[model samples]
Target: MTDLLTIRGVSKRFPGVQVLTGVDFDLRPGEVHALMGENGAGKSTLMKILAGLQPADEGQILHRGEEIALRSPLDARERGILLIHQELSLSPELSAAENIYLGAWPTNGIGLLRKSELNRRAGEALKALGCDVGPKTRIGGLSIARKQMVEIARIHAFKANVVILDEPTASLTDAERDQLFATIRDLKARGVGIIYISHKMDEIFTITDRITVLRDGVVQGTLATGETDADRVTQMMIGRKLDAFFSRAEEKFGAEVLRVEGLGRRGDYHDVSFRVRQGEVLGLYGLIGAGRSEVVETLFGIRRPDRGKLWWQGRETAFPSPRQAIDMGLCLAPENRKEQGLVLGLGGRDNIALPSLRVFSTFGVMRHAREQAVYLTYRDLLQIKTTGPATALRTLSGGNQQKFVLAKWLCRKPKLLVLDEPTRGIDVGSKAAIHALIAKLAEDGLAVIVISSEMPEVLGVSHRILTMADGRLTGEFSGAAMTEENLIRAVAHHAA
Candidate 1:
């Protein structure tokens, strides 16, 4: 394989933080190069530089045997580079054909909305990628997997020589992932180089030819997939041996803290029945679309289950809204902290204390002194990376923003907590801190329900685990029964 692109001594610094420091990396033609790192390890920064979205403070990027200055995405696009971000960017109302040929449309002598021609071209593109999206169907009506297929189709439409995929299968099922791998294989057949970025060790081993590991804004090492195992690759990413990431916690149970019977939400969850005890961490295990999120959301009052009974402390409760759930000692720290969990436009103090807005107010006026005092306590406790409480969420790193999200919910001091993928994309340090907090919470006799796709995380913090399939509970296992093999078998059965 020949080097299609090379980055040398790349460095970038912000006002007070060094995001990337003297990094070196490369991408080869017709090869799938996997990039591995914990969050905040300069992976995103390096990709941004290659895509021409951000400039580096000091470095050289070589393309096709020439040192080049890519000022913008258009400049990179002209040089055959396409980046597919974690967040999907597509017009929900637009059809597949419209989104595929959005800006650079093939127009005739007199430009008009070309329907038949657009649909035919889009069908060909989708056919090439093995996508089943109707060219004229609105994107809003498509499933997440199908929409992702459209995004891949968009990449194929551009005919880019190099493609950057960041966490492409994070939100996909087993079947969807197989389909995506097929698409990648087809792309590789056409000699398109791909940079596969993810935290999934199994995925890198299965699909990528070579793997590059980064730690603390530096290259750890690069090894061929055939020569390295997942354990070795993980050790490289985290700088230590992780034989048991899913920790074996002590088993302690208290009185029933939360009980739900006959829970039913139309088109979502149905006939859900469970009880969470104090001093216990209940793990809800499922595939991406198996209604794991819906069950928790319904419990948190984000979605009201049409026919159900909720009991807290042996008393019936009616939670009409999230506020009601919070009032009853139930709260949720959502999965997507950047969007659903925190307000980027607001300062850290405001975002943290936003849930408890009523407490910081007297006669309908928010008091800054009260808010700042509370923020100070959590800032030190959570060790959030920020200049001050007044700093905006946007200015902080992804890990820091997530810390703030957890801080906000902690301020509520609820008894029953619903956490969805508590550490989706964070650094090792942050992950450790959050795990410690969870242990402390369970020790304090707080009822905690954790839902995570990461098997290690689920197995780490839970006293017992329940597997959900489609919309019903199918399996339940204790800490003793929690092994990688057993867990996979349970989820696979549910999927069937």
Candidate 2:
């Protein structure tokens, strides 16, 4: 069979890095080919070359056995090649139908907009993808999963020949992911070629026909999906066996670090009671909109509880603001790291110092040497890969960016840490590293709380697990009680 798209000997070079060295990849009609790698393994560089976001230093690209030059995104789109980025790109103020047909809206004889026809066509497109999001609904009002559905709907409407999906299910729930897989199968039936990039082993094995691994800016190897397993693929990507992707040290619990009794926030959560002890890692598991984040935000003083009491170090207290909570030795790594945790426009050193300026500043003057030393210390500790301390945070990979967020808070040396979805959108190696880091923090007698949607993650790093549903603490499990079956049942206990 003829290849739909072929990349031969592709190489890309930045100022001080050879991102891709003689990389070769291909996609065929009616196939889902997976691209797997650790963060900074040259996956994004290669994808950008394919999407015409950047030019390859050395390579040959062929479409239908004919050589081609893709100099811009428009050029790639002209050839029916579309890329759906992990970060959504849609106008929040516009309706779903308008965003779907932004560049090519339906028109009448005089080029006036045909609003009804546009909505109808967009609705049909969304229906084809098994999404029921209202066509006229504003994009800003939709959930992340629904916005993703709208992105996929645009591609379906365009009838793209070759589609590149980057971390497509990073924010989706199980049900939404099933709907996406159905859409993919439908696209395959129509002979659309797909290049799927994800860190999830199950997702890769489930949907991909072939797997290609990239490591240190070079092609490791490609294997037929049916002929290999995750262990082999992970080994290829990281050059080592991850015998235990998650681990925790044996540590004795100390005094209770925090205690919440009958916490309630109007229209958010109510009667949420939990406690975390020193040298303990508590895992909070819940589906989206289950009010997990809301509960944590309240603890960190981002939200005030209308009812209930909080006790820190056995003393009942109230934090009226985040600064007060921080002063009291509490820190939170928010769920949306990109928007809330770190400033992408700043350099790594500046971001790491943003929250702990007092530690680096003396008598109202910035202490550059102390700040630089701290940045280097945490950079080595977290294994943050970057060109220099001055490198923009935005240029770093998702894993490294997340690590910086951790470094920022860890520098504060807080007594308790709240991590919301700590490993979202990062590679497997980074996930394991972060999990180990969490365990290490707990070993040092710091109370840690991890909020995650991934079941395996919640089960692995957490010493004790708490489940939430519809803003209520449904169940708590420890030791023998911590099983997937019980956790699943608890998460749905109060679902409406």
Provide TM-scores for the models: 0.91, 0.97
Instruction: Show model 1 residue runs off by greater than 4 Å.
Output: 229-232, 239-244, 427-429, 483-496
Clashing pairs in 1: none
- What ranges in model 2 sit over 4 Å off? 107-112, 494-496
Best by TM-score: 2
Among these predictions, the greatest lDDT belongs to 2
lDDT of 1 by residue, 87-131 (tens): 677899999988887776677779876688888888888887777
lDDT of 2: 0.91
> What would the C-alpha RMSD of candidate 2 be, to one decimal place?
1.8
